[model samples]
Target: MTFTRQGCLLVIAVALASPVLAEGPDPVRGAELFPIRCVECHVITDGAEKKIGPSLKGLIGRTSGTLEGYDYSDAMKTAGIVWSEQTLKTYLVAPRKMVPGTKMNFNGLKRPGEVEDVVAYLLEAGT
Candidate 1:
């Protein structure tokens, strides 16, 4: 099939726009997973009491272990991480592997989808 100029342009435009149109991770699924997977250890609310882990409020822009009043392991405090979605995904895959000697005792969310969903939930909840 021969491509017309307008057809090529339209295809290019759609290709470029597809990513923006694509749905982001499902926060609903993340919400479902959070209580079962994270609430016992982490809380997403701001000003909430720190439980086994620090409150995750405003977590995306914050550096790891910088939250006030939460006692972080020295390794986590020194990891110098900025919590972006990508960084959080990596960390959730294997917390100890990412930050050796860290005190987050839970092994990790082994499934990528769960990690993604959790990240989505945390990001939304923190906001």
Candidate 2:
């Protein structure tokens, strides 16, 4: 292929700008999955109320087990994790694997994509 420099730059720009080529976590899908996978145990709303799990509001920057008025397992309370996208991704894959002896009874999301989606949903919704 004979290409001018400008043509090459344009092609590169287009590739960079393509959503299919640069896909990210989908919060919409996360929102859908959250009710099915998480709502029974967790609530993302603003409150200190206890469900099966603690409210996840403002989760991104918060440290693990720091939410007031919730009883966390000793493992979670002492783990000292800072919640971020990467940290959530790791934790959501396997809660027990990441934080051994956590009281959360659910196994895990079991899919990397779903974990990403849930993290995205929590990041957006918890804010």
Model 1 clash pairs are none
Assess each prediction's global lDDT (C-alpha) against the native.
Answer: 0.85, 0.88
Give the per-residue lDDT digits (tens) of candidate 1, residues 58-82: 8988999999998899999999999
Best by lDDT: 2
TM value for model 2: 0.80
Instruction: Assess every candidate by TM-score.
Output: 0.78, 0.80
Where does candidate 1 stray beyond 4 Å?
A: 1-24
Q: Supply candidate 2's per-residue lDDT for 113.
A: 66
Evaluated at residue 18, the lDDT of candidate 1 is 60
User: Which run of 10 residues does model 1 get worst, by summed lDDT?
Assistant: 15-24
The whole-model C-alpha lDDT of candidate 2 against the native structure comes to 0.88
